[model samples]
Target: MTDSESPSGRFRIAISAWEARMSLWIETPTVLDKTTGETLLSFKDGNWSLDAARWLSDSIVELTLRKYPGNHLPVNIIATLDCANRTARIGEKEVQFLAEVESALDNALTWRTVTPPPRAARSGFASAVRRFFFGK
Candidate 1:
């Protein structure tokens, strides 16, 4: 793991197993909305990857839109995963906040609350029967 310090010295970023996967883990105190300077998210010494951050941001936006219907167009989350600085910014070109936008974000954070079905179940009955008979 190669560790790097941000210019602000607020957070540290590490790149682990880079040869196998180009994943960056960022240890930051909070993620903020660039325009509003509001704390959108906070972590308890949590290390999150850029991909995860992007997905989470997108999910929060989508959930916010569906849960509370309104005009929330062109609002996207941008992540800067540079070794020097690991940060996220909310880009709202056309912004309209939902009544329960915060609630939606909280709900989106519980993305893994529901467990997925097993591989066998996903392959269907025919695959299960074939595996049982063939001892695969």
Candidate 2:
């Protein structure tokens, strides 16, 4: 569930990876304001690809928090190929937070929470409509 709809939406994040299992998992609540018409989302590996060896270097850890990326916009992230159950704990967080994106991630083909909120459930009914009519 990306923001219901917004006027000035944006996203940003900073990712510095090393070959290790300690992939940083950052999250925040209420990124969107229904009244403002503006959206902001933060996620891991914004515009950058993560190395599997580095993201999953250690199996013992669950999730780790990293420094915030500060201000930015439209950090479009591509989805991961092999999900490997990387999002089970993320669902746990969404369940705990009762986040808007939980349902979106639940139905996603890839690891839901690792990517940005906009990336979650990116292919929606609108996409199908666009493909059908516009042939995009």
Candidate 3:
């Protein structure tokens, strides 16, 4: 989901259909404290867009699952960041290790665990263009 509520809370995550098959993904989560109104996590991507939100969420879920195979991933893991005034599920009876959860997500992202270059961006168009421009 898009964290647009805070101007500085623009971190994002992304996953692709092809990547889904590989059982991998990517994401960046950022949270802003409601009471103090301070950004708790990094939101580096300023130009991040909504079209990427679905992918981001998917990536985050996949990353989390991959990183912590035995861990039970709650359906509302992401929404938990904004479930209430707290950026984290800290000191909660339900979410025991909120900080650890966030830390794992950051580690996956920081290490570039799953992000591979988009193949479409690498395909050569010069050959096709040459064939179209010249009969040879």
Candidate 4:
């Protein structure tokens, strides 16, 4: 996954909240890996901050398994940002979504552009199936 900068003139870090159908909120205090006693994230006030940015990245990734709780997880969720035009995306969906969000943000703020690595497109159904089973 690509690491991103904080939105224009804003803190180099930002916080966002993601939730599933049950409405359970994801935070640092939440269990990351129950079997391993790992916590998904650790926010001081159910929030994200610049100081916790790196930690949040790890935390959010850890959260995916629990939040999905199964192999075939239909990733349906919402991302709420503290700042307008900030970028966020869920799972592998982040590539295109980030581009869209970041483009809008850059236009709004007139920030200089930075191109992210191109997303890989599966060449065929067999490759797609392999990736699905092995998480390439």
Q: Tell me the lDDT of model 3 at 121.
A: 37
- In the range 1-136, model 1's lDDT, one tens digit per residue, is 2333333434333332222234433323233444344444443223322232322222231111111111233222233222212222223322233323333333333232346676554377877888899965
Which candidate order results from sorting by TM-score in descending order?
3, 1, 4, 2
Task: Tell me each candidate's TM-score.
Answer: 0.21, 0.18, 0.26, 0.19
| Model 3 C-alpha lDDT versus the unseen true structure | 0.34
Worst 10 residues of 1 by lDDT: 61-70
TM-score of 2: 0.18
Q: Candidate 4: count the clashes.
A: 3
Off by over 4 Å in 4: 13-68, 71-74, 83-136
Error of 3 at 16 (Å): 17
Q: lDDT (CA) for every model shown?
A: 0.32, 0.30, 0.34, 0.34
Model 4 per-residue lDDT tens digits across residues 23-105: 55443222223334432223433321121232343223212212222222232233323222223543334423332532322
Evaluate residue 72 in candidate 1 and report its C-alpha lDDT on the 0 to 100 scale: 36
List of clashing residue pairs for candidate 2: 7-37, 11-74, 20-54, 20-57, 21-57, 21-58
- Candidate with the larger lDDT of 1 and 4: 4
Ten contiguous residues minimizing lDDT sum, candidate 2: 1-10
Show model 2 residue runs off by greater than 4 Å. 1-23, 34-100, 110-136
Give residue 77's lDDT in candidate 4 (0 to 100).
30
* Model 3 agreement with the true structure over 5-112: per-residue lDDT tens digits: 333333332322222226533234444345455544443432111222222331121112222222332312232343232233322323343345455433433222
